[model samples]
Target: MLATFNSSWFKLLGIFTLNQTEVKAFPMRWFGFGFNAFGQICVHEELIKGVWSDAVNEVKVSTPTELDNQVDTSDCCLTTGYQIRASWSRRASLHLDGFVSNESCGKPMKESRGCKDAIVSESYLTLAFSDRLESWDLQKKEQTPSWSMKLKPHSSGPPVNLPLVPGGYIAMKPPLYRLLSPHLRAKSLALSAEHAILLTASGAVYTWGLGSHGQLGHGGLTSEEEPRAVEALWGMPMSCIATGGWHTVCVSDGGDLYVWGWNNSGQLGLPSQGLRKTLLQQSSQLAGAPCQDASTTPTEEPEEEKHEEVFISIQAFPALLDVTPSCEIRTVSCGCRHTAAVTTTGDLYTWGWGDYGQLGHQTFISSDEPQRVEFFREQQMRVVDVVCGAWNTFAAGVKEEVA
Candidate 1:
């Protein structure tokens, strides 16, 4: 065999070994770019020392800043309101600007699963998982609920009561066990200012809470007491979903993106002029339609009715969006009014309200259509994830290896 080694075989083996080594050595480096209105970017002090004269209006970063040192693990939430860092060893730390109490900072985790989900608002922060939830009030500087509830898991027998804390009963309604319903077992959830969206294990999406802006995707601006399926998205399996302050977004398994709700900020990616024109045309058509009463004189059949038109200030139905001509969207996230999407090919696109430079375009201009963030492409970086805060955007990328 030593005398019969093929040159092509050796070359292939060398290539394979190199590829394996690269894969093993690949390190994930995080970067926080775009808006840093509230120190949410979390950049090193040394790097941004001379960049800003006033803290309120920070400089816009077109290039990525390394954050691996500050963020111990990839499981972290960098929101415009607050930041939560979960270490690799399963310790969690909550950070807020002069809001969190001394006792709650760097608190240890009680659940073995660590912090599975974390959400921050202007006044509070909440971390929840399958078994437990903890909340901290920013104004009061104290942990909320002030009590715990006794509950039994689905596998256990009948429920039993346990001693309660000082704040009376917390009134656990729609009991936690109800979530185990065969048809409504939620796999993930996203919360906005007042709305909540839940994605079931079966690829179905259900939304509840505030529907005033049609963020619920129920084809009506009516709030629901219970979770209701997004009727328009029925049968179209969704893999991921995100909620903005007043908008909702979801991505299908086939890479299709659907958006609904508020359009005042152009977050839905629909042209304002076109939408206004459509609304006017719809009003004209409705005004011209013959009275449905049989007693009224018959008129020409409304120009033969070519197609059905739907209009709503709040898009109560999910509207399919074509961000790019050919790119397939893999994931999407929404800020207060802005939206960001990552394509299957590691391309990042952003649109919607950008008054704070959240769109990553190096300017404070807002866009209606999806615009690719050129920084990543210019640096030959591959964006793997994107997160949007109330007024900022954070992206995680890895350097692509050239073949």
Candidate 2:
């Protein structure tokens, strides 16, 4: 028998699909794009559609591809799976037949734990049961957890996994000690490689943790062990926030977007010399022209022009990012070196490391500014939310339900 990626047991809040393919109209709620070198996105050998040609050392997926899970229940001696989980490097689906398929390596193993939800983190599996969360070292023969945390009956959610990092996560509904805001209450939280950002119910934004890359949004790059309010956005009311490897992006209540931290590859949506130079080399190669090393050929900008340009390598504090005044941003998500945002009008915009087509633009060209993913618009699908993996993106769209 064959099984598909159904959003049943693993019901992440903002994932689903709506398909009108006139064939198997499964809701295309969950769509993936970008790097699939390890098959984390496709969970298979390779995708036939929307896949770009890869170099000798890479597999760049340039378009949004939906998740398809086909299981040979009888053939593999496996039972029907109930849920699936994904990390930066692997995909694991739990089966009711006492087995788990480690899709990352195309191997199925025997298991017999009825977990309600499972999250694939950088190194281990975060299993959520009805009353507790367990951290299991499935790589080891022992199924027992290195440690475990009992959940409160009223706990808000599972520990949110931080992208592109080791042993990094935010156990939300956290202890008062981690949250320095005594009078304010947190409504949202996001973690990066080495820092954390928080949004308060009163519209205040706070950050803490490692700030070597200025991801903390402070005027200087100083790590903060305690939460510090971002004075740069003192009065602005932010609605949402997200973090990448070493950058942060947030949306204001007014629909404006703000970014900070490392812009090494324009992950902050700011001009990046390195990214520009790389794009130029790619363009030159595509045009059959000899590519010049940036070291050998200095930038063509006149000295006077260079002097006048800000040439921001890093924006240490929160900086307003202008996508468009009319495009009111509702939410945003950051990957290892890219960013994606959903507009209020059901539009999606992406930028930064497009080397893997995380931008969903049908090309493997990276950008230093925002660009619309026209594929979804062309299909008349309305984007509601987006989630970014280390080098890929997952988005969910909504459509009028079929009767």
- Model 1 clash pairs are none
What's the TM for model 1?
0.65
Please give each candidate's TM-score: 0.65, 0.74
lDDT of each: 0.58, 0.66
How accurate locally is residue 34 in candidate 1, as Cα lDDT from 0 to 100? 57
Per-model RMSD to reference: 16.0, 7.3
Deviation of model 1 at 205, angstroms: 1.5
lDDT for each residue of candidate 2 in 1-403, tens digit (9 for 90 to 100): 1022232212121111111242134333557788776665653345563333435324666777766545544436643323333345554555544345553333343222434444454545555545555654434445466556665554554332221111233332222113244354666667665678878778999898888888888989889987889999999989899888899989998999999999989888888988877888888898998997744445786666555334567889889888866789998989889999999998899999888788999887888889999888877788877878778887767563546
* Alpha-carbon deviation at 110 in model 2, angstroms: 10
Candidate 1 residue lDDT tens string, 250-313: 9999999999998866788876543444445555577996334432233665756544433334
Which candidate number has the best lDDT?
2
For candidate 2, the per-residue lDDT at 146 reads: 55
Q: Flag clash pairs in model 2.
A: 16-29, 17-27, 17-28, 17-29, 18-27, 18-28
